[model samples]
Target: MSEYIPLKYYFDRDLALHLADLIQSEYPRFTITSFVESVSTGVENKELKARVEVIANTLKQHLPTDYEEALAILLKILGPENKTEEGMFTNGYFLMPVAYFVERYGLDHFDLSLHAMYEITKRHTSEYAIRPYLIANSDRCMTYFQNWIKDPNSHVRRLVSEGTRPRLPWAKKIPPLKNDVQNNLSLLEKLMCDSSRYVQKSVANHINDLTKDNPEAVLTWIQKHISDNHGTNPKIIKHGLRTLIKSKDEHALELSRQVEQGV
Candidate 1:
């Protein structure tokens, strides 16, 4: 049997070499040797995320000074979009460095960056990349979220919720998203009964985060979602309330029990 390889190695020498080949295919001027040397050197010691940052920063150094030009070239190398919701990190691993490139540098160009994220997410994900936009420009980013919540792509719709979670793992907290509790839950309301399990799980997780800071509000909103008879999935409520129930909140416990009993 082939030995097991850790997921971090996905960003290792082979990926760097592969990325160099793709970039050269699109941009003849790309310095293949330097990019691979820079990306692979000392990368063995770094963990997954650090390796991703190394590649993203390396791309910045090797790509053109003009961000859009560089981004356009990177877009060409995206190859094919993953057709299913599964194994994004595996099937579309190559997009990670590209997404990080946009997340790190695409801030100043809102429309361009948003469009890029829309495209990249269809294959992998822009969940982490989209957070910076919320931090830098919540009002406008929220507008994009509003539109994206209804996007036909499940991955795109999932980004709207996951990107705004109050306590998304490995992502910095957005004070605006945390403080704007009512508006945040309202944004998630549209996705409450979404048909896509991927999108629904993201919605539940986002609500789970809201529960930490605004228990009363979250519980109340969930109660409304339940009582409204809108055909919202019971799991969104049950999983969303897990943290609360674990904390032994009376309201959360009772409500969760009720949902389990189909009340």
Candidate 2:
């Protein structure tokens, strides 16, 4: 097996150069060298997320001091729709910093930040960034997500569920959702039969995360949904109950029909 190299390494000087070239092309005043110098120094020691934060903070120093103005500059320079073939950490990875930019600077600008996130999500996920918003502005952010459930773009729809997971991986936990699992489940219900596998997968992962803290609630929720939509809900139930089934929880195993009678 190959030695494991942490993902943070990919955000190297080369990526900074690529980003600098893109920025300089759009805004003549952009000092590409300065941006590179700031990002490259001692960046290798940080992990993936820390490195991303370093880049975003460095960008804040170089771009407009006003958050909205800086965000506008980014929107103008963002590349075309991310090609499916490009891995998340490859081309278009610059959006990671953009997402962080929103997380760090756009909190107070609620509507504007969501609009930016909606646009950025189509290119690279704003899933990580959206969490803080959801935490800080629960009602408003939840309402935004409710509307996003019907977005024409699957990525936008996926964010509705992915961003609200009580325990989304690689991201902070949403305390409100953790304390009140029903709040999170309500949103998942809205997306139970999402057309896109991309969206459904997120919905399933969200439900599975719920299973950890509230197995009975999740199991009951899965059973109810499965009974209502036997065709599609089964796949989601299977995924949602994956952990419970693995632990041989009788209700979960029986509901999944992975075992008969007592066996």
Candidate 3:
């Protein structure tokens, strides 16, 4: 077999060098030597997210302390928006730490960080980074989400759903989001018929997340959204109710059967 590489290896020394060079290109005064040195120390041993955290933390130390100034520098480094939906991890791998940097430090500045997410998510993903916005200001965050659902960029539209997942993997749970089921469903209603499969998956996953504790509410939603003109709605319900189906839930199985029949 060809030599195997670990997933964590993506955040390796070469990645650090590449990331440092990219930032240095945008902000000439960025100290490349110091940034890379700090990021490379024992980074290989840490797990995936830890590596991202280490780099993000190091960036905070090396860059200006003021959040907006540091964000300005970070923004300059995001070269262009990723037009395709599929290549976020491949084309935008370098931005993992950059997005994390925003998640870790940008929570305090609502509008600034929210705007930063809009810009960065188009290139990479602000999925995990954007959660704090929901936590810190649910109403304000919802206002932003309202606009994001209609956003022309697929990634921005995905963020409106993916970013608000109740128990989004690799990120901490947002209790408010988990508890506020109706508001969450309202947002999902808009995205259920999204053109992008990328957005569709997030919308489905968001609904699936709701089924964990709010199964009845999700069932109610399925009752309302599903019909003969199913479109992708049945698949959305089937995936969302998969957990319940395996447990032999009567209604969930019925819905799965409906999906199979394309009704």
Candidate 4:
């Protein structure tokens, strides 16, 4: 069990319940079931996403500054069952509260909430909702990324990339990281060969995002990093080279052609 922290002790339970009720009333169709069904189908609109943001903000007001309690609440709402097929839409609805608390409070603890949040969002199949919190704490976000890279869980490993994606859909871009792409790229390097396909996708997306501003840097890294002994980790390969392929860069094009030939 995780340690206890009085982080959310100051929050008003009534307010938290009120907010959850309001979300249900406002978006009657926004149940855990519906959310799970829609995860792969794509988000309905910004309005709904915004509503989630509203709930998150409300939760923020209630979150205790301590790390453990914050994570306890997040996990409580977004627990293991939500990640299963039986709990499809369950995960999406709970994300609002978890996101709310993380963004509102500071990330000052042993970074416990950071890890738990990453685990919760990892299965969501979309990172847009979590980007706000990630960007808001970008100054300290690197540490979260560094620690997650070596996590035993594949979901946590991918959070390192997905959470920091520059142009993640539904998310506003964070300019400083975009300007100095290396910081993000360097982090992705740790998970380039992650065992999980989900993680590889994130790594590729991170690389793709960097390719727009620094194609040469990405190309050099891929050449130096990709391995022959890794077998067929196409998800990682595709994500790692996504930007180059999209831009029709010379090397990227050649690799695509090779992939097609091999197929």
Prediction RMSDs, each to the true structure:
1.6, 3.1, 2.0, 10.8
Runs with alpha carbons beyond 4 Å of true place in candidate 1: 176-178
Candidate 4: C-alpha lDDT? 0.56
Ranking by lDDT: 1, 3, 2, 4
| Cα displacement (Å) at residue 134, model 3 | 1.4
Best-to-worst order by TM-score is 1, 3, 2, 4
Q: Which segments of model 2 are wrong by more than 4 Å? A: 1-6, 83-86, 176-178, 258-263
RMSD of 4: 10.8
Which one wins on TM-score?
1
Q: Looking at candidate 4, what is the lDDT of residue 251?
A: 86
Please give each candidate's TM-score: 0.95, 0.90, 0.92, 0.63
Local accuracy of candidate 2 as per-residue lDDT tens digits, 137-177: 78888778778988788888888888888788898776645
Better of 2 and 3 by lDDT: 3
Clashing pairs in 1: none
Candidate 3: give the clashing pairs: none
Scanning candidate 2 in windows of ten residues, the lowest lDDT window is 254-263
Give the Å shift of residue 31 in candidate 3.
1.4
Q: What local lDDT does model 2 show for residue 123?
A: 84
